[model samples]
Target: MNLTRPAGAVLLALALASVPVTAARATTAADEVNYVALGDSYASGTGAGNYSDALCTRSRNAYPALWAAANDPASFSFVACGGAKIPDVLDDQVSALDEDTTLVSLSIGGNDSGFASTMLSCQYSTLSACERALATAGEYVVNELPGELDGLYATVRAEAPDADVVVIGYPHLYKEGGLCLGGLSSAKRTAVNKGSDLLNETIAERAAAAGFAFADGRPAFAGHEICTGDAWISSSNVHPTAEGHASAYLPAFTAAVAGS
Candidate 1:
């Protein structure tokens, strides 16, 4: 009997040996995460209640706090403030990020685009005023916001070179087809929602350009907009409620972080 391997088997062995095997990268453990939450009122959880501080309106129910509570990360610095703009993040919040930061979550660019003021004008002023405000904000979103976001994102990258940054976006404030009383006209609501869409689109595009993950909250709040009876947005200042933070933002951030 001849002790020899089959020619096909030998060829298969040679082929396998020629292929390179790359090891899968190990994922960071939850306990090893050094997360830094940065940005505006949305990130601080202004309307979510259970305030940890009055100044920034940092809520215990905020998505960052909720994630930190659930994961028990090594360190979590929630520096997001209520009225924070891009400059504020550069001047104040970015200080929290460092080389050891494994995770970063941000919800900025709204104030910079004058979203809050637009909403206010839409709510109190005439439809024409609302339209003008939306138009102005739209211009800012298109012309100015991209560069502002690029600068901020670049700073984040430089500070936390090893971290995974996740940028969270705003949701539509009103259910388009839902019935409602006299808060805002259907046209105003639609315009406001359109503004939200534009803002989210800009943020998502910039986040992707910076090699960061984007967590869109629009889908999460589809049926829970302000006009809907079961609203996730607070009536006070159009910010997310505790339920919104817990249900919409928390899950969105969680999924983005996991995928990142």
Candidate 2:
């Protein structure tokens, strides 16, 4: 059956046939990309300098912000809040996510196991006292924190089912067995660093179990820890510098998301 049609009509028919296919591709691309940031002080860029708000302390120089500036994604939501614990993330931050979200970067679990308090307690304490404090922190990290984190990961997965979640771990505060200038004694520094290792290990395991990516800051923050003259971590001994976020954390996160 070779019924001849006008050239215009034939062209119109071909165009109509292509519309649905083109639309499908566009939808897929749109649904799979919009970066969302979520987590605690580190993620919020507390010590990175330029604050978005006093409440969150989200620095414009944070890794998520830097990544967005570089990649120019279709959209970006920086919902990470300083001092956010796992429970707070569940309650507050998950609202930023939806099915369409395709990327997520998180730096939580520090506050969950009382990282700041542990460090504070280590100050003005003997080696024995510092070790005891670290032991307590390590117990919480291994024994209770994983389940809490797993529950949060489940919630995040449910909210943005298809998003590539990259879980970032804390940096070791001081060089192991190095001379520390801060109030922390050598023993305290060693203990705190050990606690940091334990936390990172637990976080990496949970991320693996949940099919998420883990961005390790240990190697990146290696030469730039607290006691080092060119430390990337802040004087407060907790958060990263603007340079830290831009260089170390940003690269680690971008690599993870790209690999995914």
Candidate 3:
């Protein structure tokens, strides 16, 4: 008849309160997801800020990190590295995956296309030279890079057979059919966007062939590309700002995984 909590009840409450929140999260292993992040600078959180590693630049603001935090996956591994190419994923990041993996998010192939060098060449060279450089990159994209993506996606599928592997593509670096300003000329911007489009197409194809979802970020990033003044990409022209990742990349990934 006494309205008092029992000693055992109080002790149990205290014990539960003392246990860390992560333990509570880990307890639901059956409902928890095992997410593995793989790919290049964009996936590595380079411009997202609050880097966990100087070399890899993995950030809490990166899309994968944002997704993990929002979803509270049972376990999450951020292995994506800045400048990682397809081979980098196969050689390093793939080890994080296994039969138990539930999800994967990747942004690669940009570096493989020598994206930075191509952009630099376009920026510094004459119009014809820039055109030629982009043409060459397009050749690699059409001729050689599909095979690389095929092998990478295939390996990811083989390793995590049941996982939803979402392959993320780069954003167009310029606004189309709009007033262009800043560093890149209208012609260069158009060429850059073309190369990006080709890369995205190839990636989407390979993802489809490998039975993975490809998250094309160009449409999501429309009107927000570099030189738009509302750009989500970093000033240096590559990688997304934190807002960019949150706005474009995050939504794309969420929708792809949801549809999957």
Highest-TM-score candidate = 2
Model 2: ten consecutive residues of lowest lDDT: 176-185
For residues 1-260, write the lDDT of model 2, one tens digit per residue. Answer: 54566776899999999999999999878665698999998998999988887789998999989999998888899999999999899999999999888899988898888877777778766778778878888899999999998999999999999899999988887766756765476767777888889999999999999999999999988898887878898867467999999888988888888898
TM-score of every candidate: 0.88, 0.91, 0.86
The numbered model that scores best in lDDT is 1
Q: Give the C-alpha miss distance for residue 243 in model 2, angstroms.
A: 0.7
Candidate lDDT scores, in order, read 0.92, 0.87, 0.87
Candidate 3 structure lDDT: 0.87
The list of candidate 2 runs beyond 4 A from truth reads: 1-32
What is candidate 3's lDDT per residue for 1-260, written digit by digit as tens?
A: 65466877898888888786767667766466899999999898888899988899888899999999999888899999998988889999999999899899989998898888888888888878888889998999999998988888888988898898898888897776656555677787888888898989999998899888888899889889887878898757467999998999999999998987
Q: Is candidate 2 or candidate 3 better by TM-score?
A: 2
Worst 10 residues of 1 by lDDT: 21-30
Model 2, residue 240: C-alpha shift (Å): 0.4
